[model samples]
Target: MSQPGVLLDRDGTIIVDSGYVGSVDRVEFIDGSIEAIAALNRAGIPVAVVTNQAGVARGYYGIADVEQVHKHMIAEMARHGAHVDLWLFCPYHPDGIVQAFARRSADRKPGPGMALAAAEALDLDLAKSWVVGDSPSDVGLARAVGAKPLHVGPAGSAVDNVDTFADLAAAVRFILGDGELAMVTRDERPVKFPAARFHRADSYGGAYVNELARAFATVDLEQVSRAAKILNDAHDRDAAIFACGNGGSASIANHLQCDHLKGVRNGTGVTARVLSLSTNVELFSAIANDLGYEHVFSYQLQSQARPGDVLITISSSGRSPNIVRAIDWAVANGMHTISLTGFAGGAARRRAHVCLHVDSTNYGIVEDAHQACMHLLAQYVRQSRMTPDAVASQTF
Candidate 1:
């Protein structure tokens, strides 16, 4: 059976106090919240947002306004380097000022409606999930689903089922444990480093390099082929392919753009429509400034990605919040996702439609293998569609 997971309250738990936050300008994250959530993500625990927005019921804001605010919140978290897997909200209030929202709804706080809905929608094991909030109602709702209810802020009168935390960071630390331990399994096989190499600095470095190389060598060529086929099929249907990564992986995104968009059908004249989300630094920074970083990829996916499009994500650790959020969005929207990852499978792997895993924990090895996979896909596509002249030119 899978382990228990984490659910978070958005307003006061993750973000600081903001009454009925309806604008991006109003959203501010609690200190260490991003790191805490990221740690949870690394541990393969799904992190969701459960919030009560009484503003909707009060007619102070509409559903769209609430969604926009959430988008801003997500964007901010992304900028800060955390990802929210799912967001569940209750807009109803029994004492709502608006007649339309005046009735008592199961989705309202103190009830488990939204949490239950999130459980069903996200395929979560409610019994193993935790809900972190700053209010008694949040605690009650979590307990209703048999989930762990952790309260943030000052120790309140002890509730039977709730655990009190000094802050969000403290709660997250308890839930995620230490960040030093690697979580998730990328490849089924264990990686071995040579003991002799460790004795000599130079030899150890070389051995480390060699081990990485060997790890890259294990990336299945057939899987690359299958991924190429998927991309090709998508191309045939005139669908878009979106790629994302960070740092070195971001470079890989550019490389993939060159290969998939330009190199694939160079001589054969077949063009695969592709875009690398990491390319535009200006837009990224702008969004980070205006919206926040976490939403950089997700917002793009929401705007540019269509149903049946392909999303290819690259990560050595397989635990980037932005990438995971993008994958989550893709999955929710019925888009296909291909994940290239190292270390343990991470959240991205579990959520991906197809995962190309690199077994090694060493980043260099994983990156190398990712590059090789990229090359293999490009070369295979090129060769498959090569004309007589193109083949002849390659022969000599």
Candidate 2:
């Protein structure tokens, strides 16, 4: 039944004991106590509160008043994003004057009845769980139930199997593991390609290109369909679809522009708004000469992109600085970015919201697959826009 641990004691353990804490205003949580409980909850552990209230027997407060205080505790915990699963309290006192509450019951503390009842109700594995309380009686009860007992108070009484804690918060942290609270920071790793290892003999060729094309043909058709729909929607709204790439990938970007803008709307009433960022030699040279090569796409995107427009970048290695910069700019400026890449899934692949990774090391194969992806999306959109009657009437 996936039985997990956590047995807690109320009053001095969870809340500051204010003798008959009947009023909602009197309820207060110990420091870091709520956060520790929340961490246990996140780790899929169940927690229950087992407390003894002698106030009911002393006539200081009734069971209903105790319930009201519990209710207030639950509300306060919720506000702090922490919640307790159950509350089990023993209100009986053996030497009290009230006839109904005077009897010594097994459910009263110093006996493990309350803890046992909580264990049964919560379906807990008692051996794996620990109990936290401020009193020696609380420790005795925990020990009787075969559970770990943590004593939270100044040193005084000697308990055999009890661990001493300063407060409930410290006890909670001890049980959940303290090292998890340390802050962790991460920086993006630089992309490194082994250009020195490769010679002209290992360059892109027919075999490599064919292998890449075959891999591309296996891309999930559903993704292509969805991308095509997004492209078509933008086109219908007169929004631009910008395509970019590096080297062979640049050629694929050019091809994507041709198929999407020319092929898709060849005979249809719809004309797609498409632009290949790899195109325009003059602008590329000017940007490379003035702002440097890495800034070329970023510069163009700054001037052309708008909110809701789409930017698609293709890269075999996926480490192209210009492409990554372009994608970052587009996304930050509220444009959707998609990447098509290969070779261990590079920076661009990770940066793009939707990545079509070609699981191949060969540049030729990756570029070919990328080109096929472009054609597939464009063709799908074209076919989708065609009426059934129009398609049926067309000659083979």
The candidate that wins on lDDT is: 1
The parts of candidate 2 lying over 4 Å away from their true place are 1-4, 97-99, 155-161, 177-304, 307-396
lDDT on C-alpha atoms for all candidate structures: 0.76, 0.74
lDDT of 1: 0.76
List CA RMSD, all candidates: 18.7, 14.9
Question: Candidate 1: lDDT of 72?
Answer: 82
lDDT of 2 by residue, 1-396 (tens): 425467787877788787777777888776666655654553446688888887888788888999999888887665443568779888889887777798787878778887777778888878878877888878877778888888886566535666787876567657756653321111111111111122233332322333444456445566566676678778778889999987888888899888887887765667778899889999999999998999989899899889999999998888888988998998899888888888777898788878887765656567767877887787767777788886676531
Candidate 2 clashes between residue pairs 3 or more apart in a chain or in different chains:
212-365
lDDT per residue as tens, model 1, 137-178:
888888788988888886664556567887787786666543
